[model samples]
Target chain A: MKLKEIAHSRTGDKGNISNISLIVYDQKNYDLILEKVTPERVKAWFSESVFGEVIRYELPNLGALNFVMYDALSGGVTRSLSVDKHGKSFSSALLEMEI
Target chain B: MKKIRIGAGAGYGGDRIEPAIELMEKGDLNYIIFECLAERTIAIAQEEKLKDPTKGYNGLLEYRMRKVLPLCKEKGIKVVTNMGAANPESAVRVILNLAEELNIKGLKVAAVLGDDISQSIENYMHLEVLELKNPLESIREKIVSANVYLGIEGIVEALENGADIVVTGRCADPALVLAPLVHEFGWSESQLDLRGCGILAGHLLECAGQITGGYFADPGYKEVPDLWKLGFPIAEVSETGDILIEKVDGSGGLITTATCTEQLLYEIHDPSTYITPDGIADYTAITMEQVAKDKVCIKGGKGRVRPETLKVSIGYKDSFIGEGEMSYGGSNALAKAQLAAEIIRNRLPIIGCEVDELRIEYVGFNSLYGTKIGEVLNREHTLGEVRLRVSGRTKTRAMAQMIANEVEALYTNGPSGGGGAMQSVKEVVAIGSIFIPRSDIHVNITYKEV
Candidate 1:
């Protein structure tokens, strides 16, 4: 099953970096997510768009994991020629990751 | 048992007005906060100011004041906002005049200035821009606006001086909500924990409807009811900095632990250390629980001492973008779209443009993913139609417009079934960040009463 089935995500941007938060609907699924969703896996999953390092932070209380991807916005909303200037669709793109 | 009710109104400059009106009418709000300015907005507003001094503030400030001031007077609700994008003093005057026209008595309006550091920006040319490798000197000629992200100082001062409406430029989004908490409960600079909690509350409330299910709706996955009539969020805060985020009773949108958790992580990096001018917030300890229907209580946020320096956003003229789109349908639609893209690619150079970068995409297929989405996308059946989009970035506006003109010419010159052509050309305003000393920046507040 896809991560979207058990978890949801939202993408935000600042400068050239993009931050995506993945949260599980159930607290029981947090461990499964934590075990499978490693920073290396995420970096490889988004290898096409993400260039710089990917840092992952754990929010145990909220059953969520936040991933900060650097050099992700193609120089950000101002100069990015991408149709999705703010990378809004990246959240949906992240949901496509299989667990 | 001291508590206050604050409504989140107008998350951005172009936000919906009806939800804010709903809050004003029925949310029973003691205060309403609107966080409207973006990083690139003030730079564009600064350019507009050069064209007309009276027009630098948010374009909808007049319309918002006209709609909310009369209700504010009747309901005795205070207003705080960063709608004064490039000019706060002028925004103050606009509100004062709006009060007179509406005949709303005893309304005091205040404006916070000094966020604009452009005149003295030369002194900081040696500082390193956080985003770019270049120093300030490289973009000095292209600089249009430079403004600091102020904390609660200016807004708190306005509230302390008995101003019913507070207007400011370039204040941090969380500061718009945190300032009122400081003024009402007498939160001191040393009360870092409470300040942290308040800033966290501000962050959750800053985006308005996002906390109340505007962005959380997914058809079969996560369901949010009555999303079309989405309601903005309201925060009920105790003196100890505990908060309950909810919306008006019977109003649309859902408020649950899930929604609250999503919003808590939205637009934030380093959840443990969120640095602001007022305090450095630690969100790791935060806990959310559903206390009642459409309400979630938040608690246990940590905080540290405030930063010694403030962040400044620098806006500069970047470049120009030109784009055009045309669609082709019927048999061999994919082939036609590919041929159209090839034709445009060959013709863009012939048209003569100093192109820095360019993209040719088929709208239904590769525009978003930018490449093949595995064999599934390739294993298509009965392809109907595809739109070809060509976009380019150029240093000159004329050169950029030439790309759009060339694509437009494809209708009569190149393709057979190309239809519904659309094009656009605009100047790009980019943003840069730098840290400046707190002591070097000054804030000035002016108040006027009706």
Candidate 2:
């Protein structure tokens, strides 16, 4: 199953760092997410797009995981030549991650 | 417990004024705040201010004031905003003039200044906080504007002095909401938890309708009603720092646990330490309860001491961006768009244009998803119509313009049935951050009455 099936995500960018929150639709899926959605797995999933390290911060109470991707955006919006300047659609890309 | 109701009127500059007008008329708000400045926008506003001293505030400042100030004055709802982007003085003056034009009496406005550090940025030793890894001194020649992120103290001071409206330049976004809580409740710096609650409330409402389902609507699953009529958020903050987030009756949008959760984590890197100029708020244990439809109760915000250094947004001229797009339809549209992209990529270097970076995308198929999903999707599906988009960055506008010109030439030179051609060349004002000792920036507030 794809992560999007059980989760909804949103992406926010500050400077070159891209933070994507993978929030579960149901709290019951939290354990599943914890086991499969490791930072190493996410880093590997986005290896082609993200150049830097990936750090995941957990919020079990909220049933969410925040993935802060360093150097993910070609550059920050102001300097990047990419069309999706703010990386608004990056969350959709993260949701493509299969579990 | 004594409570104050504050409404987030505008999220960003150029945000719709109708929702704000709706808030002032019906929200029963004691204060309405407009977080109009973004990180890099003030730098661009500074450019305008330098050209004409009286013209640096948000472009729609007067229009917004004209529409809402009359109702706000009648309702006794105080207004607070960072619409004073580069020139608080000028923005304050504009409001005063508008009040007079509307025949509103005793309209008091406070302008908070001293955030602009362009004059003294060169004096400090600072490293670039974002991209373009260079010392502040090295980028001195290209620096356009530098402003520090001030806190709630100045806003508190203005309210203490009986300001009807407070205008600021680059104060932290949350400060716009937190200041009122501090002023109304008399919360001290030692009351970290109370302040943190207020900060969290401000963050939730700072983006106006964001927490109220504007950004949460997903057609079938997370359905939000009457989204076009979506109401901006209002926070009822109790003295103890508890808040009930809601929207006015008849206003569109839903306030739910899911919407609040999405916004709570929006742009936040760490839940435990969400830093603001006021204090470091810990949102890790925060809880949300759906009190009713379109209403949510928020609590559990803890705070720590403020950062010793202040973050400064520095803007400098980076490069010019040239973009061009042409749409294609009929048989093999996607294939035609791909060819058009290749033509622009190959043509740029041939014309002696030294592009620092370049991107060619087929918009209909995979402009946003990149190669990961795009490659797999392209193999299975075919696009009926596609737009070829070519964007590049270069030092000179002339060179950047060449990239767009080459794309437009493809319409007449090759790719059959190309239509809706568009091209643009824009100068990029790149923004980076640097931290300066808090003592280095001095904040002051002055009042003007009409």
Error of 2 at B126 (Å): 4.7
Kindly give the stretch of ten consecutive residues in candidate 1 chain A with the minimal lDDT sum.
A84-93
The segments of candidate 2 whose C-alpha lies over 4 angstroms from its true place after superposition are B125-128, B377-379
Error of 2 at B187 (Å): 1.0
TM-score per model (chain B): 0.97, 0.98
Q: lDDT per residue, candidate 2, A1-99, as tens digits? A: 888889888888888888888899999999999899998988887775678999899989889999888888778878877778777787877787778
C-alpha displacement of B64 in model 2, angstroms?
Answer: 0.3
Lowest lDDT sum, 10 consecutive residues, model 2 chain B, at: B123-132
Tell me the deviation in Å of residue B26 in model 2.
1.0
Residues B74-132 of candidate 2 have per-residue lDDT tens digits of 99999999999999999999998888888999878999998999888767646665466
lDDT of each: 0.88, 0.87
TM-score for candidate 2:
0.97
Error of 1 at B340 (Å): 1.8
Q: Please list the residue runs of candidate 1 whose C-alpha ends up more than 4 Å from where it truly belongs after superposition.
A: B372-383
